[model samples]
Each structure stands twice: as structure tokens, then as C-alpha cells.
Target chain A: MTDMLPTGATIGILGGGQLGRMLSVAASRLGFKTHIFEPGANPPAGQVADRVTTAGYDDIAALEAFADSVDVITYEFENIPTTALDALEAHKPIRPGREALRVSQDRLTEKDFLSGLGLKVAPYANVESPDDMASAVAQIGAPSILKTRRFGYDGKGQARLKSGADADAALVDMQGAPAVLEGFVTFTHEVSVIAARGIGGDVACFDPGQNVHKDGILDTTTVPANLTASQRMDAVLLAANILNALDYVGVMGVELFVTQQGLIVNEIAPRVHNSGHWTQQGCTIDQFEQHIRAVAGWPLGDGSRYADVVMENLIGDDMDRVPEITREGNASLHLYGKADTKPGRKMGHVNRITPRQN
Target chain B: MTDMLPTGATIGILGGGQLGRMLSVAASRLGFKTHIFEPGANPPAGQVADRVTTAGYDDIAALEAFADSVDVITYEFENIPTTALDALEAHKPIRPGREALRVSQDRLTEKDFLSGLGLKVAPYANVESPDDMASAVAQIGAPSILKTRRFGYDGKGQARLKSGADADAALVDMQGAPAVLEGFVTFTHEVSVIAARGIGGDVACFDPGQNVHKDGILDTTTVPANLTASQRMDAVLLAANILNALDYVGVMGVELFVTQQGLIVNEIAPRVHNSGHWTQQGCTIDQFEQHIRAVAGWPLGDGSRYADVVMENLIGDDMDRVPEITREGNASLHLYGKADTKPGRKMGHVNRITPRQN
Candidate 1:
């Protein structure tokens, strides 16, 4: 068994966005200081982290220095460049490991991996060229979505196809980048299972939360998601299967589509997910803290929900209501220290908690 | 009403210890940055704060720079040098105000203020010399405790007087500092109410938590304390009275001794108290976050308890049990990033939570 990190160990975080900021706070709660490495100056995580290295991922010297300064490394985002990981892995251990990232970094690979584990996912076909797009359309049919294979997030880098006649436009939207045509599933609603795997391969999963997205961005996630007991069990089991298969040792957010047939895998985030923010108010230990514990080689905490919570994201102009939100008796607000409030950008979130029904 | 601080405003905190560390995290959660000022090198708060000013309180230049950089100022420890506060207050507003500090900084003043407000407090007499000690003993009688008037905490600068025979020795223990003779109250148990006052004079108090002390240090604080509904209401009312008395605009920890007759105010802390740490898992917003909200002139969050929590302190060697503690399914451990753990030094705490019964 791997030795657990003692208090006062420094954790190297690869990104400095809101996820990294929250992760840094959680790391500090566990007596771990974080050193955030981000290309952007004055990133959110840097505001609370012990230190920050402002350099691009391709800067091998910076990566080596960051890796050498910390005991263990973890990342807030999975789109980290392969060359950067190659440099970092040589010097330090990265929890969740490289395989988890390699699988989730690409759309096609994530779908293939989930399907290989006997989990149902949207039918998808790789589209490398215009001809491939026609073939994909023929196979996957119309009313599918064409998404880039890599480096897409928050509804970015995706194009919708209404019919076969729209295939050429969707193909053009891909800008000749490698893409995947995913046939849309007629699902009732979306839910996500936030699970963690300890270094010793122990898996723990929080209750799945029903998610609602607006304009391709997550708007709210409510606990006690409309899931039957059997569906809940399947959600957790599938998430655990993915974690164990990858030998993952960190928190993973598995977005699932609750359909008439069964739970279909939508996607997976290898770090703390937005849908899991409700856990901060609803569970004993939140997803960020659980991730910190898992990466630090501590035992995974019980992720059972103790309260019903609805977590709503404060996006851009939604931040204008903060003063009023602050006055709400049941609302717990969490704001990221970002200066700019661009449209669709997440500024903060609030979790409204209520007593759990037995 | 004071205008609320904008999201990006900086909060200046004095005494960069564990309290400041937790407060800094809370400030970050509200989109505010913290600048911690401490005389010691590598203070715990510095690990999670946006800026750290390592300079003595007497350093006027450093104080000026810090005050100029922050919108509001607050202190973690009440023993801050008067000259320092005078310097900082000239530049920025200090929430919970200087009056709250002046009253709580000295035990005698605190006792006097509570009694003047028609709150029950243990009989106390000021002691400046051996003659005064003898007079105090004559008045307050035996089984009294001699505590220094200033710069004392965690049972320090205190001597127990069993009878008249021990008066001289107890006076000697004072080391010539001004003291207070507090007649020991026969209390069934101790409870503390964590309360907050917003800039708008809105007050909110968390349910009192029963505290257990070991060797004059807080060991555990359990919510749903052994109190009748009447006692609970009295605790909250008295706490609110104290806050209004000082026109306080921040969190206060009011420690009370439950006597057969009524609740006696033992003392009050101007900042978030250790006994209230249970709220981190029991409430929608923890005491630290409430303190930040009050100081920032934002609306106070609901302080009602939603869970039954027992918070246990990890002091000194108790940190060794952290590995075992982390493994406990219901435990949520919070470790201070203190490099050295001397005997009696608080290392961290854990809050074990369960659902609240209706």
C-alpha cells in the first residue's frame, strides 16, 4: 500500500480555474498547501494557493520545477496536453493516473471505454473527414451531434445536425478537425454520479444528482434525482466499474442519461464536477474534500447525502442577484474570485438545502 | 446602513493563525481576497491567503500598507496591540468594532459589561495588588480563579485559589499584572452560542453547542446540547443583546455556564470560536463564512443547525490519530497547517455529523 501524505505536504495543481480554486481550498482544509500552475496570470486558484507558477504547459522547465516542489500532483482539468503530462509524470505521481485522463480527454475514446465496460452510451462514429462525416451520418442517422474529439468543454466545439441535409454544415463547423457523430438519445433527464476511488481501490459514490443544462451549460443539480432504487444502484455500480477499471484514485463525475431503457453514459469528468457542487451542502464530505483525501492516500469518506439540495449556478448576469441571494435563509453561496463576468461564464453557485426524507 | 463590500475587495486580517486560515478560505468562497498580517514567518493563514505581510504590529509602514490595501480590517486574536489598532482604524473600518474588542480583551471588562447588561455572570473583582487580592478573596470568597486582565488565553496566566491560604501564591502567579478574581460558578455544563450581526443590525445565532474541556482547553463541542427550548432561546437572546450592545457587525462566540438559576455569561470572543466549529457540518453556512459576511456588510446567512454534530479538537499528539480518524466513515477532519505541534497546541479538529431529528 502507498504511504499516505502527511500534513503540510504540498499539492501541485495543474489548472487555476474555479475547480482548481475550490480544490485548493479543500487541500488546505486537509493541511496540504497547493501550488497552482496556470498559463494565465492571476488565475482564481492563485488567490488562495500557497504558490503559483505562471507558465504554459509546454514549458518543460516550469513543469519540472512545479513537480519537484510538490510531493504529489493532481489536476483540475483533463484537457492537459500529453507532452506536459509526460514531463510531469517523470518527476511525481499524478493521482487518477494517466489512463483515466487519456480515456476521457477524447470523445471517441471515452465512449469506447464506457461501452467496453458494458455500459450503454450514445451511439457514436468517428468522423475524420467530410467523407467520414457522410458515412457517420449514414450510420448514426440525423438529429445527431458532431463534437470535436478533444479539447471541448462547457458546450464548446460542438455542432448539431437536424437532418442529413445539415451534415455538410456540421462538417464545416468541425473545421476539418477529428470529430465524433453521436446520435441523440431520447432521455427523460440527465443525472451525474460523483464517485471517488482511494489509492487502495476502495470506491465510494454519492447519490446521483439530477442535472439541468441551459444553453449547453449546467444550470442546476438537484439531489434525490428522479431515479428508482435500481437506477441509482446501476449508476453507482457503473461509476465504480469505470474507476476500478482505470485504477483511478480521485473523484470522477460521471454524467448519465436516464432513459426509458436504462442509464446511458453521457460523459465523465476526471475531477470535481459542477454537478457535484451540491455535495458541499448536502453531504458529510464534499467532492473537493473527497478528491483531496483520495489523492492524499487517505481513506475515502462516506459520500452519502444527508440533506436534499438544489445547486444553482450563478452564470454571468445571474451574479447581479447575489445581494438578494445572500439574503435567502436557506441558500449557501460559493463565489469564485473572478473579476470579469462574461455571459455564460460561471461566477458562483448557491446550494439550497432541506431536510432529507427518510 | 454601511454599503456592502464589492466582491473583489480585500479583507485585512491580523494574527495569521488557524482562525485566520479558516477565515481566509471563507473570504475566498465569497469572492473576496484576504491579506494576512503576522509577525511570525510562514503563518498558517499565509498558505491560503492572497498576500502575507510579515511584520510586527509596531511596524507603522507595514500597517499603513496593509490598511491601504484592504477595504475592511479584522483580527483573529484580541491581544492585538492598541497602537496597531489605532493605526489601522485610522485607515479602514474594523468590524465587530473596537468597542467589542475593548470589552472582551480584558476579563474584568467583559464581566462588567455582561453584568451591566442585566446578564448573569460569575461574581468578579479586579485585582491589582496583593491587598486587592485579599479584599477580593474576602468579598468573592474561596474557590475563585485569579486571571490576568489582559493578554491571556487557553487557561494561561491563570491561577486557582482554593481558599484564603492560597491567596498570596495566586497573586504571585499573576506576575504583577492586573488580575480579576472570578468566583467559580457551580455549573452543570457549559454551552456556547455562535452569533452574527450584519451591518444592517440583523442578528442570527446558531443553536448552542455543549462544550467539553480537557485541561482548560476545548476538547469537544456537541450540538443539540442538553438545553430546554427556553434555555436555547435565552442563550440566543442574550447573545443578540450583547451584539446590539456593542453595535457589533461580525460573528461572536459567547460562552455560557448553565447554572441552576440561569445561563451565566462566562466570556465572549470577538471572532469565530472553536466551540462553533461544529456548524461547519451542521449549518448551511459555517461560522467562518458568517463572520466574513458580517464583516463585508453582506446579509447574514441562516445559522440554524440542520445536523447534529460533535466537533472534537486535535491537540498536540492527538494529530497522530488523524490517520485513524480519517478512516472513520462519519468523520470530517480539518487539520491546521502548523509545522510544529507542541503539547497543548491545537493542531486541528473533526466534526462528526448526523441528521437532525425533527
Candidate 2:
């Protein structure tokens, strides 16, 4: 049942954003055609995809047709509607499986699963009602965060709690959605492990990259993140354990907080993450190709880092600096081909190769 | 008039083979869309391009429409029909210009142009008639080659002359077409420089790569070709002189023969050469991207190579070994997404990274 997809097979991707765009290019590299299902017209991925279905996920007929045309189904984003997945999964296999999506869709479930596996996570509790919120505050205390359990990204759908008295205001930020209250874990910095699990249960992890965020968005990711040998080993091992627990079958991004006591798991994304973009220049085989290989059931590639690289996202107004960036030596520019430049929009990224420190 | 193409502009490619396919991917990396014009249905480039026109080159109306749809025109192969170029050039800028095409279209003109620039070339004479063939034989002697002046590649339209008595047989191979009789020269090995010229007249050349051909098709290209520093500088300078003389804007492949005398110019290709494919693994900027940058009027990327690489072409039954190749570590596989693999057809190529020797 784990037969690999043959060359010339069409892989259906659910979202047609920049991640999907890079994945489409990587799929073409391996002699596979890609069919993109994007709701927006002229999606960034559609320009490179072999075919695109410009229909909403609610259009079950379109989803079924998209599934029927491809050998397997994979996604760029994890917030896919349940009905769309149900329809598509009926026709073809969706890699990373429903179990991964089920475990990662809710913050409460993901935290519980990681903790159950003997991994350290930020202290948290459910905030469903007024009494529950008070009990959560009493248990976890103030200086925490109230985050909706699902569909939150890039600092959206989140509110910070200054003290126990601020619980009501923070709950208001949830806007009636199920929420999780997380106590702040003191950490020096953040790092992420880009890991992949093949169909035959083989796991591989790229070296951790240190991430720095600005205004709740990823600004830059630097490889060879300052870490002791033991910390790096622990990061890879915990990421592997999570993938094994979920029986995952594609690349997963495990964000970890580096602390004096130990590394704490912050979050796990089912699809490729922004922090892994550096692999495009640092490794022979990048994260997008790694995910495609796992989903296609092919043998994994060598993910070893050969150079020091810094990947910086070009968001919004950064497009104006393209002409200057194009002249910078050793900088690899990758533009998203988006039509408009809206503030806070991820325009593209540039990977700058730097000399390795011995 | 020398202005850079803004992001979101379309680049129209004239041929839709593997080279065009890779070019389209590179163009997309720089935020430009690609439209491929090819007579064949479902060309390999079309699978990744934003648009594809499936009309013959003789269709002037289609050519005009394609030109109108793009900001500039470039190509993968050099054998484009003149009438098509006439129509497309009327609507948009055709990069590399007509002078380049005129000089490279015929073997006689190419040889004359190179020798005119004081570059070393094989001794040759025109053979348009029986009397001319006799004089060419007398002047060049036996153990030579008689090749048609136009549309010859991969050892086609060529015949060997073992002796003066075999001149008639070699002429017969040309089928009464205009031909050239060339005297052979002894060389140690063959090397090629993949060089590019920007709109601003800036020239950059990748390191020479040693080439080995099998059955007249390029089999392998190894970087860091064995050459003294003086020989390397001579190769690059000679290539730059040719581009400068022609005012060429795009990447060109300059094939050279290494002999006891010096490097001899074997031939020049107006498009990216197979020998330059190793740059995909060895350098920060590859030949395809360098070509795109030149055509788009942008500054050329850093052409400096940082790693040792060997590129091997996969022809015919080589597709059968893809599974084994995929499992090999450090081997970067680039399949052309070709649907059929016929004998002698280029299905794809693989670039293997090796340790750099001091």
C-alpha cells in the first residue's frame, strides 16, 4: 500500500500560496506535475502549477474532481475545511494523514499530545467559560496569553494577559471561539527543527535554525543557531518523537523555545514552515523537496547543511528594495509574484549565504 | 533605453525543451512569469510556464500575439525560423539580437566570425560545387570532415573524409547542400566556458568545465577543468571579446579545444550549454538564471563557483535507474518531466557534488 508515485504523476495541492508555489517547483524538479486548488484568482502557485482549480473548498464537486485527477493529495496549509478533506480523501490518499491534522488543528490537543509523550510544553489550561477562565488564571497565574484553540497564525486571534484582572479583556479577544490560556515560559530564544518522516518510518531532521520575529511575524532565520551539542540533539529527538507519535508522513515544523532548564516545544505545524526556507540555499535538498519526497513515498534526500545561511522574509514594502537586493552579491532572491503589495503581506524571501564560522 | 524589467512581467521563450523548462523555473524565481511558444502540444516547458502557445513558428499572427504578451523575447534553441523572428521582433525586443543569430546560424559564418576576431579556429574552406570540393580537398588534405553549413547538431549532416579519394562520398552525404571541409587538429581534451553579458555590457564567465561526449552527445561535464591560470584567463577573455564584438546580451556557451598550441574555439552556442549545467550545483547563480538576468536587463548574479560538481546527462534507458539514483545521498536529480524516453533522447541530468580538492 506504500507504493511510490511514478514519474509524471500529478500531485494535488490544496492551497496556492507561496509555500505551494515552492512545492510546485520542487515537484517539477522530480518529474512530477502539480495541480493546484486555489480559491483566489491568479494565485502565486498557479503561475508555475500545471493546472489550477479556482474554486472554494466548499465546492465539493470541484474538490472531488481535483482529487480524481491526481495520484495523491497534499496540502500547503493545515487549516483545510473538514468537509473538503473528507471529499478529497475518499478519492486519493492525503499525505501527513488525517491524524496529523487532527492533532495539530487545536492548540489544546497538540499540547496535551506532546506532554503525554514526556515532552515539556508551556503551562496551559482550557478557557471555555467564565468559571473556567477564573480557574485557569488561578492555576496558571497572570503574565500569560489567551489564544484561540484553532485557526490562529502570525499573532492573529491572540491576546496577552497582563494580570489576573485582565482575563475578561483577553477572553473578549477570542471572540467566542474555544481558547487556551498559556502561562509564559521564560526562554532565552526560539529555534525550529524542520523534520520529515518517510512512509517507511524513516525520519530525518535539518539542523535547527534560530528565528527572530518582529511584530509577531518571522523576520529572519539563521542556520547554525547558537546551541550546545546536547540542545541540538534534544531538539531533533523530540521532533522525531512527535512525528512518530502522529504516524506522520511529510515534513513537519517543530518550533522549540530554548531555555536554561531544557528545550520546550512551542508548536508543531503539519506543513512546511517559514523558518525552513534557509534550506533552499544551505542544503542540496531543500524542505519543499523533502516534503514532496515523503508525500510521494520516495526515499528521503540528504538534508545536511553545507553552508551558513540567513533567510530573511521580504514582507510588504520590502518589494521596493528588490532592485538594490538584485545587485547584492551572494543573495538569492525569490519573489512570490503577487500582484499587490499589502502591508503585513509576505512578498517573498532572500537567502544570503555567509562564510561558516569555524 | 536600458531599463530593468519590473516584477510580474512576462518572459516569452521561443523553444520548449528542457532548457526552456529550467529557464521558466528560473524566471519564476525572480518574480517574472514565462510564456512558452512551441509547435508541439504539451511541451515540457509548458508544464511549468504561465502560458503556452501551440502554433507553428510560421504562424505570424500567433508570433505577433506571443510577442505582444511578453516584455522581451528569449529562446532555448538557436534554430528558430527567420520569419517568426521577423514578426516577433516587430512587437517586442528579441534579446541576443539579430547579429548573434546571423553569425551562429551557419557553420561557415560562425567560423569566419570567430577567426575575424583573431581567435584560433580549425582551417576550413567552402564546398558549394564539385570544383570547390576538389580545391577544398587539395587545400585541407585527407582525414577531414565535410559538414553542412546549416541545421547540423549531434553529429548529424556530417561525414568523415578518410582520404582525398573519399571527397565525393563525403559530398554525397551533404546531399548537394552547401558544406564546409575542415582539417582536424589534435587536442588533449575539450573544455567550454559558460559566459554571460548583461544589458549594461558587463561580462561574467563561469569556470571552464571539461566535457566528455558519447555518440556526439554530451555525456558528462566536470568542473575545475585542468588548465593553467594563464590558459583559463585566455579562455574567458576570448569569450568576452566575442560577446563584446556582437554586443550580445544573454548567456553563451563557448566550446574550446585544448591543444599544445593553446585553446582553440570549437564552436559557440547562443543559448545555455549542456556543459554549464554543473553550475546548478557548483555556483550561487546557474546558467539558466544568468541567462534570464541578462535578458531581463538585471544585474548578473555572482557566477563564482564554491563547490566541485560533476554533471551527467541521462539519456534513453537511463530513466530506469532513477530509483537507484534517488536513494543515493548528495546526488541532485533533475528530471525533465518528459513523458516518453526514447533512445538518445535527453530525459534528464543529475549533478553530483564532490569534495573540493585544495
Candidate 3:
């Protein structure tokens, strides 16, 4: 039973967002039940999960009870509170492990880890105070992005440094939080490799998907991305290198910037990523199920691409287009049951699949 | 809201079986919440449904509460008690309606309805007692089946009549229940069409699938079923005819017997059928989602087959083969989180997908 979770075993999830919702559905497919722990009432994942603890991560008692009820623990987001992890890990194993989370929870640690593994990453310098920002700007030069070292997502908590004069203004954006000044790497496009590592240390990566972002949020991801044969291999190999370096178990989203020199590591997330949502229609096994299999100690599934797909996020008013999308052939819609639709919120996504081009 | 259920609407499901489990997952994809009503403790569907009411259909108070919570209602199985429908329909609209349940609940009524619509049906006669059994055997001839008109599924409540001399013995198997004596139709292979009709009366049907039954239970269903061009067309047309005649607003599985002369109607299930499970991998929108869409008052989705699939049921001890199946490339395992596998029980199924042949 330790080698793999038996059928009907409960998998504890730390977040109850759309990723957790999809993961719960995938776990159910493999005969595994999911228990979601979220502070928010009526979280989307709670609608599909077997059990939900509507207590915040700071509530140690609720966290312990949730951990005790599940056989294994995984998460939808990487930035889990440290105290919550300490309480849960004592009862059950947290998959993708603490090391993967440690490396990914901060932009600085992730870049350093990727670079230490001899993988290409954009040049960066740590920034803390105004003095640190001045030095980082001098080292990295203008046209660099200042991103907070921790707790930043969907392009929040960051400011662009167009010139050295903008450094103080950018530092103000961080609000005294530690930051990283990353030198911009001129790239043709952004692509992400959704990779998984089994408990047995076996690695599998889905085809890279070219992505487009609108207002700092992912707009669409098209599979069979424009990559040379060598670039594709490099992208997968670099992802596997990162996973192996961390001794990672479960899926990791490896975002890469396709540059003239090579595929530069942008960042990594130690759970299912939005760009990989295309696998729901492009492959036999989706990223959510792949993550579940790894965390549950099952062999990684085949990640072969079987269809050409373009996954588009349904943000806010994009939901108004649902009726039209419902009528469109080849478009598969996945909507998160959120009560309110606000601008920039991810309501869901649609995967438009077509016959494979190659 | 009258034309189509808005996202976040609750769909009340009548039964909590594997069909309900899959339907709940499908409903979640469309941002719909599901409330499952099952008498049994820890029903498989409860693992994924948004809510569960553990009460029998005879509990009028519980049924009314469930119906009040949902915007629409549907069932996984057709043989819902009349009293349950009476309580539920008064609260929320039940898609596929009571007409479908009435026609399909009794075999004699179903056969007559098909024949009445100019559809070919196996020769059949009603049986109420020993005298009726003798007359049925005389009229339908030898090599027939005696089936209880109600509560029959998975080859249950049935006995074979090999000859006139076996009439009394087959009557004993009925145990005084109303029955149907049906002459077996000579056929090459059995096929079924998974059809759906929208609230607006538009119809869509998935490609026919060839079925193989072992121990009176479906073993496997292969898409691109060996049907000639004309036989395939006839299969879909007959299925649409039934839905149109019944004014059905959900998915229906129409089992057809392919004879040398033509396609003959066997029976129709007013919900997603096991034989249609192959569509999970072979079609853009599987039958479960198709049923949800129709019941939710949305337009029918694309049911076009995208891959060749062989859906194999994992029954009883076949659960032992799950580890091996999980490793098989192009195979998608869907296990019902049912504890304790006994002989002749359905544990789950796997869809092995391959490129479409034609």
C-alpha cells in the first residue's frame, strides 16, 4: 500500500481553485477520492471534491484533521504557508516534496537552482533595499523586470525598469519585499513544458505549448509550439534536469523563454499549470491526472500529443461567449463554478482540438 | 434562464451509480453543481457530487428538498419509482421526462412502442401466468427469452425458454411477475447509437459502436462498428426517430440488432449507456456531457468520432488488472470508487484509443 495508493484512497489537496477542481475529477477517474482544504467558502474545487475543510491554512487543528483523513497530500498552488505544511507533513507525505516547493516558492531560488543544474536562465540579481535595487539595476541594466522574490503570481507584485532612473519607482512597487531584477532575454515566444516525475524517478513531459498573455494573464496556449527538433529536446531535458535536481515527484510546469541562444528558464511551478490544460483534448492523459498518478505513486502515463489544440482562457466577460463556444464544434469548455465574474478572474478555459498537423 | 441553465445551477440526479458518478463529473465541466440522491451509504457518486442526500425514493420530504435545491433533474437509470418522479417533477423539471421512463420500464411497452413507430422489433408476447406463458411460447416459438417486465438489468430477472416444453420452467423464473417472452433476433453483431436531443428539439447522435456481451454483461464496445454505410445511417436514423417520438431532452442509448435484412431495435436506454463509454476518448464531447448539456437546456455538442476506441469493462476481479492497464499507452482507466469487489460486479472500465481507421 505504501508503494501506491490503493483504489478509494483519499488524496488531500491544499488549494481549491480550478486546478484542484480538475485534479479532484482526475483522481476520481483513477478511483481515488479527494479532500480539499480551502479557507474560502464555496471554493470551486469543493463542488467536486469528496470532502472539504473550509478552514484557513493558519488553523492547525483543521489542517491536522484533513491530513489524517487523507493517504497522501498534494497541492494546487506552491505558496503554501510553512506552518500549515509542518502540521500536515507530520501526518501524511506531501508530494512534489518540500524541496520542490522550496525551490519554486521564490523566483530567486528557482533561477539559482536551474542555473546550478547547468540549465540556461535569464541573468538576475537579488534586490532588497533601495541600495540593492540600485546595484541590481547597475548590474542587470535597464529593460529589466523587478519581481518580488516571493508570493507573486499572474504578473502581480512586479514592475518593469525601463531605465536605471525607474529603479526607485520599481522598488516602491515591491513595497520593501525582497525582489529579483531579471535581465530581459529577447525571445521569439514563451513555451512551457508540463513535466511529471514518478516516485520511481521516471520523468515524462508533454509537448511544449506556445503561450500568449493578455494584461499579464494567460490568454491562450497553442500546442505543437514553434520549436526546432533540437529546441524541443532541450526544453524537455532541461525540465527533467530541474525535476531530478529537486528529486521531485508530481507534475511541474516549466516555463521557458525561446531565445536565440537556447530555451531560457522563466520559472517553475510544482503543480499542474494552466498552459498544460490543452492535454485534456490533445492527449490521452491530462496534466491533472498525471500529477495525481505521480503523487499517488503510480507510473507516469503516456504524454504523447494526439491532437492539435489551442487552449484559451475564459476570463471575466469571456464567459459571455460561453453560449457561442458551446455551439462551436471541436471546442471543449471547462467552466469553474464561480458565483461572481470579475475582470481578470479565470472563470474557465476552452480547448479547441483539431487533427494533428504533423 | 428558462432557455438554458446558467452556470452554477444545481442539477439533481436520481441515482448514485457509476452513471451518476460520470454524469456528475461531466456536469462539473460545464460549471454545474450536482446533488445525488441515494439510499445507500457512501454511494460512488457521492465522492464527486457537490452534495448528497442519503434517503430512499420513498422519503417524500427528502425528495422534495432535493428537487427544491436543483434547477433541473435527471436520472442515471430508467426504472425510477413512480412516486419519486411524482414528488420531484412538482419541484423541478425532469429532462427526458416521465414518458421515457414509462415506455422503457416495461419491456412489452417498449417493444410495442418501437413497432408502433415502424421500427423492427423482435417478435414478442406478454406473459402474466402459466396460461399466458404457454400462449407466448406458442406464438413466439422456441428459442426465446422470458424477462420480467420491470426491474431487469445486466441479464437479471431473465430465463431462457429453449422449447415449448420449457415454458412452465421459464414461468417459474418470473416468480409471478409480469413478463415478456421475446423471440431472439438472428443477428451478426449488436450495435448501439448514443443519441441526444436538445430542449429546442435539435438532435445529435454519436457513431454506432459494436458490442460484445459476456455473461449477459457488456464486455467491450468498439467504435467504427462493422456497419455498412446504409446500416450505419439506419442506426442513427432509428435512434433519432425514437428521441423525436418521445420528445427526449437527453442522451439515449438505442441498442440495435444488425440482421441480414436490416437493423432491428432491441431496446432503448434513456440515459448514458455503457456501450457508449468509448466516446470518452473517441469523441470531442462524450455521452455523459451530451446528456448534461441537453438536460441543462444547452445546444447539443459535437459527437463526431475523433479516434477509434475499444471500451472494456473491468468487472469483479478484473480490478486486479488495473496496474497493468494503467501502464498501457493510449489507455484511459475510469474506475468507480466502489469498495469490495464481488463476482459479476462492475468495478470500472478502460478506453483504449487508437487513430481512427477511416
Per-candidate clashes come to 0, 0, 0
Say which candidate scores most in DockQ.
3
Q: Give per-residue CA lDDT, model 3, range B13-106, as digits (tens).
A: 9899899999999999999999999999999999999999999989999999999999999999998899989999998999989999999999
Candidate 1 — which residues are off by over 4 angstroms?
none
lDDT of 1 by residue, A220-316 (tens): 9999999999999999999999999999999999999999999999999899999999998887889999999999998888888888999999999
Q: Score the docking of each candidate (DockQ).
A: 0.78, 0.71, 0.79
RMSD of each: 1.2, 1.3, 0.9
**On residues B253-326, what C-alpha lDDT tens digit does candidate 1 reach at each position?**
99999999999999999999999899888888899999999999998888888888999999999988888898
List, residue by residue over A175-276, the lDDT tens digit for candidate 3: 889999999999999999999999999999999999999999999999899999999999999899888888999999999999988888899999999999
So what's the TM-score on candidate 2?
A: 0.99
Judge candidate 3 at residue B232 and give its lDDT: 93
Candidate 2 lDDT? 0.93
Each model's fraction of native contacts: 0.87, 0.76, 0.88
The runs of at least 3 residues in candidate 2 whose Cα sits more than 4 Å from the true structure, single-residue gaps closed, are none
Of candidates 3 and 2, the better by TM-score: 3
Error of 1 at A107 (Å): 1.2
